[model samples]
Target: MISIELFAIGLVLKGPEIPWWLLALVIATGQIGGKLLHYYAARGSIRLPPFLRRKSANERTGRWREYLEKFRANCHRRPVWTGAVLLISAASSLPPFAAVAVIAGWAKVPLVTFLVTGFVGRFVRFGALAIAPGIVIGWL
Candidate 1:
């Protein structure tokens, strides 16, 4: 159960331990969660189930889709690297997290591109604590 949660959470939450396998598991969950959210949102005025749509459209995810369009526009201006950075930055955006990763994957971003950049960002975020205990402890 924890592994599953870890995987789901890892897509957004920064943490340590929680094996790669667990992260992968959470990634799957996150993807499913996002797809479900998009499905419900686009389905009608329903726009996500009660538990999912926390903020008003003018406030949160309504803005998220707009941002995604902008990001894609920028991607067209450059290339995959542009998306990688945009996506990497988005890791910190949504509270439900994994909004970008799952969305990107759902957008059918090449598996290799998403994994390389997403994992790189995830690990960099993870490294601050997940690996560099000596640095973190020294700060403490």
Candidate 2:
């Protein structure tokens, strides 16, 4: 967790030499941290902090109800996939973090699944960015 925070700090500081190990460390930390946030919300141990608690949470919860209409659902069904999707969305800024995290919490998405999915999603996304640059640059 601290390492992830440090990564963010390093980004802000414009420091060089973000090691490969730190990159993996941060992604793993971020995924786990995101899952814990959802779990705590589900367990009722924590209240949504002011930024996270709002009409948005309720709105997303309502949206999840709509998703449930399709079939029986629980947090565990595709933890890795769901986590990947949510984290990918968050990482890519496709959806607001609060919407993703809060709805995921209410949906009871299992910790393990989300962690796996989110990790893979983030890994693939980042990995693609790392690996595809040469191919992309060549096309230009």
Candidate 3:
């Protein structure tokens, strides 16, 4: 999503004018859809025999385990923190949304919660970008 943020901002700054609400809506929809796909993909992979297989000694697999462990711990012991983390991940570039969404899915966060938070966060994120040029130019 960060990959496309700059381009969206550039369009807002240099291309034809677009309503901020429309831009934010479109961006939020695309981002949420992308994240949902990522979540389901992660869920599906976990259900696969190969993915559920015993962990190997590979460094990459080790790192993945660490991520999952942290995710599980956060979900169980610090649900508020997990929610904040997910919200921040949705709203910003730090802690890639794909990873966060996958973890959320694995942690069994309710689908309604995921979608609502994701949509709201993404709306704010893209809304900020969409209006940045206006703010900078004192047009808003």
Candidate 4:
């Protein structure tokens, strides 16, 4: 997510000109829409770009595949944990939500779980950001 740009927009829209929830909803919608594309690509429902595909059977690609396999196995074993991680990533961007989106897709997380968690988390995140400027200014 473009944190700086969102925060700046929140600052500009700090007053009653626009509701914070509306701004949050719009941003969350866009973020989840893009992430859904990534999820589908990883699920093989959508084609991946050439750069994302393996061009050669190199050591790096091999290692990455192995790592992904392990991750996939873990996801299958502990789906709730995986969903929790996705929620956290969406909310705080602690581990980068884009990477998590790919992982969730590859791991075959249920579409409902992905959409619900991602949307709720993103809504919370952007809503807080949208209101932050107003709150801070009120304290001043």
lDDT of 4 by residue, 41-140 (tens): 9889998789988687665456778888988898889988888988999999888888889888988988988999999988988888877777877999
Model 3: per-residue lDDT, tens digit, 1-140?
A: 25778878887877647898899999899989989976776666435467654475565457767878777776878766767777888898568877789878877776776888788888989999998888878964
**Per-residue alpha-carbon lDDT of model 2 for 1-140, expressed as tens digits?**
36443554445335435544455556656665865676568546688667766665556456656785332253356555566567676556466544666566666666565555556555654444443434554798
lDDT of 1 at 10: 51
**How are the candidates ranked when ordered by TM-score, highest leading?**
4, 3, 2, 1
Q: Give each model a TM-score.
A: 0.41, 0.50, 0.76, 0.84
Which candidate leads the pack in lDDT? 4
Candidate that would win on TM-score? 4
TM-score, cand. 2: 0.50
Better of 2 and 4 by lDDT: 4
The TM-score of predicted model 3 comes to 0.76
Q: Flag the better candidate by lDDT, 1 or 2.
A: 2
**Against the correct fold, how does model 1 do in TM-score?**
0.41
Q: How much lDDT does each candidate structure score?
A: 0.49, 0.56, 0.79, 0.84
Candidate rank order under lDDT: 4, 3, 2, 1
